[model samples]
Target: MKKQLCILLAAFLSAALLCACSGKKPAEPVPAVSAAPDVTSAPDDSGNDPAATDKPSVPVDTSYNPETDADNLYSSANTILIETEDGFYWCSSTSDYLLFYDNWLEEMIPVCSRPECEHFPDNNVCVQNKKCDAYLEAARHPALYNGKIYYIDSNGIPNPNVDGTRLGMRLFRMNPDGTGKEFIKNLFTPGYEDPQWLIFHRGYIYGMSPQTIIEQGEVSGRTSIIAIPIEGDETTFRTIYEIDNQGWGCMRFIGDYCYFWIHYMEGYYYVNWDTGEIIDEQQMGGVALRWNTVTEEIEILYQELLPKDGYFGETAWVERDGTIYVPGGDCLMKIENGERTVVFEFKEEGKHFVAATVSNGIVFARTVPEDFDDPYGKSEFWVCRFDGTTIFKGELPMDWFYESPEFEGLRGKPRYPGFVMTVGDETGLWIEFGAHWRSTGYNEPSADFLVRYDFTEDGGIEYKLYGSYDDIFIEPVD
Candidate 1:
């Protein structure tokens, strides 16, 4: 009987162990670690996190594909509007807010998504209380690349001193929906200014920094091509190429080479900033340079000498296939494979080709009177194929702005149409009319209109009203 009791006790202990094992839950599978670094995880030296602290927690999309990103050809460092995948992202020209246009909804809204959050005044209940996602304190340049929006904020970080001044400019990036805002790097300190021509290409942000150097009672400016890696911290800032005694001019990129112009300031006259005295009076020439992005080598493409009173337009453009186009006095010149060719020469009397640009295999040339002086004077525009076939050659209809029903009250007023952009095959024109005069005795357009023009297949032209500038903003104007 004692042996039987021992056997039953052993059986009961085994059964109890089995029941405990089945009652417990199985462990969850461990998540796989991401290969890309968490750029927002690291804190700065000041022990403060650069990422938005009050931002609502949202899942980040890690499927960024550079190959399918939008090409940022029209947006430049100084441009207010930047094209993105969905629509355009633009900084308010009149405010400190960043706005976005939703193509599907056909509505413009601030980058902030909080329904009850006011964008202004930094109230306790507003989005600006902690930090507004759309607030750009002195927005310098905002660009879109590789599914991210990059921009420079001049007054982003506050100084530790008693005065309420800013420390320096900060580079930042955010998602398309204004979430996951992260600070990339600090560009410069108090004495230095923000760089110009902010462009995000290949995996870096390229810009031109016009730095002023003073040594031994002489003042000189150094224009440098700066490159900063998009995924790097502050230590990755570098000057790829620099030009002494020159200033920054026009810059364009073609493939891996960045084509730009640097003006000569060796003998140019300029007043001293500190003393306000005139310096050298003789003006010099300028040179166009091509910088290789990979090798960081610079090559001079063209050079032109200027007289004391000569005006250098520096109008040049590069195509995607490494073809360069420049407008001379009366002809359009094309350079490819080190071979210079005159694509077209205007033999018309009293007409001079002033500007030339290429878009979607078509060349647009502007011609003006030989004695043209007014900056807003009437000029003729010529649209031609790559083989020099004339598509259309005539002056743009300036009267369309006055005739449009949208500007009913401002009919027959002095209107000026300026080139805005070229989208697909259509060219955009921004019309500015004298609606009111400011307190500074300067006439400014209270309302501006954007119109798009395109030539049809049968040589007919069609004009469409894109939108009004005032319609995109939320604030009311007088």
Candidate 2:
């Protein structure tokens, strides 16, 4: 399931690709998605396959809330509902860089929104919906920081190579009510493809866009993360991080530092936001996932998963109290005062688990789907109180569907979510989704399709698709 990832670029920039090519070291077993256009033999599983190894399986919380909140979901949930002081903040991403993965991000976004579903109905996915249009996908992970909901603009058009004109993606700013539709920066340039992510830090928005280079006229190499000013003109954009001869394995900004892990065959390097540092070039040593600076300490957490070669390990996480709460992954180890009691079962192989940020003392963990090997598909979510006593397994809203930004018909979308935080205000959540169609295949239907579903039914399940593409419009959900 490897797909293309788009990074937004703010300035007209280029990097010097002049690595000696001789001093490169051998690769360790870090999980990486290759640039290959198609799927390869399953690289390393993120944290499942119990029979292969005996790790404590993720605790299965069988909580159910079927009538209202579909706790036992089977398919897509476009609007990721989050509780808040004002109301529920629906988290989502929309961007055009999705063309790289054949709509993978478009497909994946729905998964994050709903998580659990027996199976998503065919032709029901927003990107390829029968008649629905106005489907917006994510350019970068949607960020909730300092009580502001941040996302980039869906300004890009089909790539000229893919289409005929070189349409580009731009960054956008909006208040929670979808009010502030302003162009923070124009991310389209001749050399830079698109910017996909936006991270807020020190009152500035940091983002990354990888420049595509055709090696030997076809092979792809190198990826980089650039920075954008959340409050300035486009000219002042800064490309804070870059890596040579590697792919962007994972990127996230924790607190003041922006973390980018570049995974290469020989291993990976950690690109730090603070001090403009790229110094930590550690051999992955076969540890799953790269430069996992997601936690407070990188080296300590790395060795714990590894400990030794003959053993394999995995670690799962939950950000609580500003400190990353990693239970365990490949190998089993515990640190930090009795807080994280990582046991053997907490190891990767046996238990399959997925978690979101903990709020109000409850950590939300989604169960793995049964049909697909990937738990990400057709799964359900459960709330496990961090106190270590109760798990509230329940269903999400009904009739929800998910698709990645790359999904056909979906222009901007990315799946790896940024973060979910409940603000002080409680919200009346309406997981609004469905798209407006542009046209029929090939000819490019001009019809714009738009539809929506409200979980609480404040607005009944009213939607439209399969008509003139021009008819599509995102009418405000009341």
Candidate 3:
């Protein structure tokens, strides 16, 4: 009996050891987790349509009183709203664009102020009975470069921050205030990709990406330099040039005969968009050739935008004082005398802007941490001056994308600004594509529609409620 008792005690001790082994220091408390980060959803579709409510006609007061309708202002949710029939940002109207934010759905208002409104093509395109609705995305602080509001299609075709579904982005055009819209139908074949290389300039919009859209099994190569006329909806587009298997990034115009680019993703490869010919292919180098209309030929200039060791990634090239400028991994480069000069040095590695542009004397750049959930450093923006001065260092709220510990699921995402473009000194344009994403909430729009913060006599304003500026978007004005 004593022997039996000893064996039982030994078994008990073993069991106790097993239990202790599984405990694991209590798991460091496992901080509460959330679904993915996304804004809340709009309350509900309560549009005051005549067929539904048939209430007395009430005109939208355009008194410019922020104190009365502060909630509608995009400063908190969307400062402006665009009204159209297709739901959000749709239609071929490229003038008289309206911008506005309503109860929850940030609106892309359509303007009927033009003579063409009386005979709008889309008005009767819905067939004899079926109705074709109009939609428009908001275009605040719109910029009219070539008879069209310079805008980008912020469709989340390839949002890299999340998995499962990839959100894609494209460029588009609209009226200055948000009336007319001419969709830039991207020639995306089945397996096509832009690699985030698109920009608008000199009456034409251009970019390059990989594709399998048309000739599916044909090597998946044949990258091309596509050019779309800036003449609105009726504008014809064609593939100006094609590359067998070259990757593309940001591009800059050199002159009538030349264009320049930094392949970015893998190595350095530049192509002349005008000729669709690669100027050169080198594993490592700095001197670049940019063609300026005024100069008329490819000129040798120094470019420090490419990283000798690490990948230079994507960039936005802008012309300033007849010189070319760009932002890269940890520095900003100026291409002047056929050599790159590091005008500004980024403080930290992996902390850089995905895109940039130049307007006035300030260097408008969008800097993000290479690691989305970067733990060691700031994860938001690194806006800097041409002289490398950080003017607006507003913190980006991307943390809402991840939730851990408690559930550890993606919050999906609350709808937020799809793209950000600076129109002027203080005003910027924000686009919401009526984008409904998937997440912890099971496929749905963001939870919080309009974020309410400080309450004035009119309404309160809140931006975080929409989501962080950089999180809800990918790149480009589109």
Candidate 4:
């Protein structure tokens, strides 16, 4: 069951397994996909899951249709979509209209010229179909700059018959409205690797190459941080940094710096983007360090054991201003000048922090009851002021797969919204929400439900659900 969920949510699995080391916490008890989602575990008869609850008398409405819905405030029908400064874009698995939401008019505009044609089978429009010579499969990891959008045009799986030089993933750029699309460059040569991270800054794109084995038959692979010239040929892209690829971790680029880590045991690093220089490094040693990206400095914010014990806890941390807040263990705490101050401690015996973030003077956290013992338990969302005053705390009514009572035991975990792109003072979260599952596995090949959480609302957070897409990438408008 654990393996199956990892594959189901491969994008978030890295943090699922080693989030203790990374500052980013989980928003739900949903276990990360360590591998492909196809792996399954034995059925458990004991109802020890925290996330499970009796079927409620009133079922939450989780579905929406973009085609019929006219309201701009709320819509549930369109899935696999993204919103940028320019407009909102959604790629459908069924429809021919590669949809775009006009930011100015506040309406969805279909970009395809062929009124009768389903835009998918024909890649002439927004999507990268199987028919194209480069054979663009799906668009992933999008970034926006100037007036154009850049993303990973993932070619399908490797073909042994194809030449090595021609194989590997490609970066693509296009207009925000899904016009003037073109390939940028192949991510790697003569080998295959998926990007763990992608960032567009200062007229260049930075990506961390996928892990490769240290040696043939060895488990781990060598990893590298790559930089691509936005306007240059493939030769213009270069490997800025390289290290042993620690499987099941992540690298993130913010401003002009990059934060990197592989797993709990391997430690972490802060690198300078402009010079490809190592700014600082820290070993977890059972301790998690908080880097103040704003101040360009690092601090040891949380430790599992006392200095005498010299150990670290699995707790998670987030930074704002110069203070570090941790929301794991029994109590949530704020660390200042090496002092631990209690903020909001969990009175409940079993719940702990799954994920958290601080933006615009507000702290948003997701927690789950630990008593259930199941990897994914019922999750609660908490919103509070930076001072630790609670604003709102309630169950995050997100059930990705609507499982019947008979199949309740086979339900999937509650997943984190993967794409949390902070735009100025506002924050947007994009991730797969609901699931359509069958006896064998997921009912659909791709995520059926794409949910967006808009934390920029005046009163509180607002979310919209979109469904049934081959692939989707959302980026904040520049």
Best by lDDT: 1
Candidate 1 least-lDDT 10 residues: 17-26
Global fold similarity of model 3 (TM-score): 0.41
Measured with C-alpha atoms, the lDDT of residue 273 in candidate 3 is: 91
Give stretches of model 3 more than 4 Å off.
1-133, 136-223, 228-245, 251-260, 265-308, 348-380, 394-478
TM per prediction: 0.62, 0.40, 0.41, 0.52
Over the stretch 1-478, how does candidate 2's per-residue lDDT look in tens digits?
2111111100100111111111000133234332221121111222334345433332222222121111101011222332223222233322111111012222222211112221113222223331111122443544333333445545556444334366555555433332233455554433444544444443454444555667677645455544444555543344333444333333333332333333333344567788777954343222112121112112212312133222222122223223333322222323243233443232234446553323333334444446442213454443334454334334443232233222344332212211112111011112222233233443221221122221222322232211111212232221
Return the lDDT, model 2, position 228.
43
Ranking by TM-score: 1, 4, 3, 2
- Count of clashes, each model: 0, 108, 87, 31
TM-score of 2: 0.40
Cα lDDT, all candidates: 0.49, 0.31, 0.34, 0.39
Model 4: per-residue Cα lDDT over 106-192, one tens digit each: 443444322332334312232534232222234343443444545665463342333554445667765543445786666553234
Judge candidate 1 at residue 252 and give its lDDT: 64
Estimate the lDDT of model 3: 0.34
71 Cα displacement, candidate 1 (Å): 3.4
